[model samples]
Target: MTSDALRVAAVDLGTNSFHMVIIEECREKGIVEIDRVKDMICIGRGSISTKMLDEKAMQSGIVALRNFLVLASQHGVAREHVIAFATSAIREAKNQDEFIRRVKDETGLKVKVISGKEEAEFIYYGVRNAVKLGSSCDLIFDIGGGSVEFVIADSHGVKLLESRKIGVARMFERFVLNDPISEHEIKLLEQFFAAELVSAAEKAVELGVKRGIASSGTAENIARMIRSLQGVESDVSLNNSIFTRREFNRLYRMVLPLRSSERRRMTGLDEKRVDLIVPGLILFDTIFRTFGLEEIVLSDSALREGMVLHYLQQHYDAGQNSDAPDIRRESVYELGFRCNWNRDHSEHVAMLCLQFFDQLIALHGLEQRYRELLEYAALLHNIGTFVSISSHHKHSQYIIMNGDLRGFSPSEKEIIGHVARYHRKSPPSEKHVQYSQLKQRDRNAVDVLSGILRIANGLERGHRQNIRELRLACNPDMITIGLRSHHEPDIEIWAAELLKSWLEAVLHRTIVFEPLHDA
Candidate 1:
């Protein structure tokens, strides 16, 4: 393994199951998941309503934690590097301390029963990395066995976070009386969710949360269930799929008629979650309708992934100043590093792109928010070369659109991908499906940013860091770009000259470049 590879594991002692994931953190190569192990212990199946973990459930939890510890050890993850977190079920248990002590005594492992607020925070951490939370406000919810967490956040940070004891298991124990869930039972369930989520609903509406994303098994099951109803096979990953309110309503209608066993036979419904699916859907539908969300995005990452990200932020990140203003920038470069990119060249291009963006602020008339997208696109513009050099621009666009680059919204990600797509090859056109899907404003931002990116890329054609500084002189009809370099920068000037046409077209100006030397 390269020197950057650091092995770490996160064990989530969830109420429904125990999951542990071992990951390889290569300084340059984002997150490489090495191994994952999970067991259906159902520690909160019957005890959630009682506010305690039954003795059998406690034993199952202990056994699962022990087995998970062995798996982590087998993967060479030191005990100290393993982060084990326990959520709602344990947190609400009167004997939670006893369980924590018992686990320590039996397996020499400590379990942290996190508060509801912290659990919400971790869910946000995990989902933000998987889904682009963009600049627009988003309501992210995760359904666990004993609780459901709701967070209202954006690209900047979380605005509101709350976790409630409204998990499917808890609802199943209290309401789900009929096999086909009688109308009365469904109403009670809806009422409970409505009352419990009133604060979350109001906060979401107050924050203008038109977008919603659901994480953990509940959302995944809903996405899969919707796909199954469309007569599609259950092999696809629903992580990136957008589940709209209309589709959710359709699935809600279709699934409510089936009994638990019949529902289990449907593809994509987890066997373990069969009994709890009804309450889960009710909760999902309640939130969708209550908040008036346009669609609900599914995030496969949840508490487990959240724990891992928190560990990396606290440990692996270097050169990040306190308060972490550049967390997103650092994350973008980390992905480039993972792709085995030319760090020096990518950094140089990013620097030059930012220079152009700063210098031509008057001409672009774009806000500073677009600056981050430009920087990320420039840094990752060439990572598609990892797949192939020829047609790498297209490949780069695909990778960036798919890559889990942190600190960008879905719209911003699309803009970045388009910017990277047009960085070298074809310019942005209506024919490009992904580019065409963007809103008009985002499309304009992509064109302007992509135009600058192409010219900056040309200035670094040699990848030798030959160009030192670029200064632009603009007039009503002509824009003169002056390049300052140490040596006779002939190759750089020639490459830049060839690519000036695209910038000239976008800016609607006659473009000229000249080499200037210091006396």
Candidate 2:
């Protein structure tokens, strides 16, 4: 679609409600929110018990979707341009297939069920796009109908993403029994939330995250309430009227004792959200206490906004490169510097490893990312010798896994850790924790990269820079690795023998190491 003619719409099939936003994308004027709709279906209310969407709840959602489809069509939104996603409730429901089929039949819109990790990614995109919070580290919280997603990301990328079962609708249905919410019940809920918050907070700290951004209806409502109390226009920017922990706690305490009816009478609390206001407040307060956040800027956008941005970035702007640098390399380089490894030799080993990887890419089918990881593994393979000589590979694995790597995802870190672990030992196995944590694809990548690193490390064993050049020739039966060096064949032979076993185990075939006397 042309930039000016492009019209995009997003539907968030939330647990408590179905929400949609239609935006007209004008290149010169920027994006304009032209139409918005919300239908409170409470899909999570019935999903908790049967692990299946109740028939009545399914009908409620279908009706809402049909109405939305009509509205979208009226607004000139093409069926192909509209993106619809279902979150926690529908994703967890056992009979979601029937519900989705019915929705598709009635509304003509395909519903995409997103996992919690994907949900967190979209939320990050939304908050990052909507707000100009200058903080490098941000903790984003989205309290939805059935689940709460917490993400830690920065200009670099997502560091940690987690989702929990505590949400506004669930909290109210499971906890608040009294109209005003009795003090006894309040205490019990507070204790329960506190425990969860504490664990989440610890994990966030461990991941080196700071600052905070609140997203979704619950957080936005709190921001509106705070704004109304302060008598300010809600521009929804971080600078003007963000809430400090002290002020947030004061508001939480004030709202805690009020009845549901009384809460509706409050300036910022929406009438429909009265019953959930108490639980939402408790969630906010618990997070504040757990993280010890001084203040948090409220974001007007959440998962739906993020999803639209992601789709646009992926399809419309194909030239944009968002992948961060290789975190593993940075970590290894830093560790090597700290351990006082010979920089010349370390870099030489890494360069040779990458050279080997590039020459064998067609045969191995490994991606460019794996080559980068192998470079990193080679650089820090000898770092463990700083502590001791025996089983330095084990020490290196622990260090790489625990160290802070800026550009790597949790999955990438697992692969890097395994590659370093297997540099001088047997190939990665199920018994290895780091290897086990990785998905199958990543595990395979680690195995191939580790195999290459093992050979590179062996070739450099002389530590005197004896080997000059190497060539790799591969076939279905075996890999013929030829080394060109100026020195005697004794050192190269010993190293080649050590690498042969690892190469064979990884490729499940024989490996022949050949040494060339002269160029």
lDDT of 1 by residue, 1-519 (tens): 566577788988888888888887765666767888888788876677677778998998899889888888888888988989998788888888998999999999988889999999988887776676667889999998888999999878889999998988888988887889899999999999999999988887777889888888878888888877888656645565676888889988988989887987888888999988889999988887899987877777778877887888788772222332444665687778767898899889999999999988999899998998898899999999999999998888888877766555556667888899998867888998777878999988998999889989999999999888998899989888898987788887788777777778888988888998897
TM per prediction: 0.79, 0.59
Model 1, CA-based lDDT: 0.83
Model 2 global lDDT (CA atoms, 0 to 1): 0.75
Best by TM-score: 1
Cα miss at 206, model 2 (Å)?
Answer: 3.1
Candidate 2, residues 298-409, lDDT tens digits: the string is 6766787677767777888621127432323443565676565677777777877887788877877887878877877777777777777799888777766655443354
Residue-pair clashes, model 1: 4
lDDT of residue 242 for candidate 2: 65
Please report, as a residue range, the 10-residue window in candidate 2 with the lowest summed lDDT.
Answer: 318-327
- Model 2 earns a TM-score of 0.59
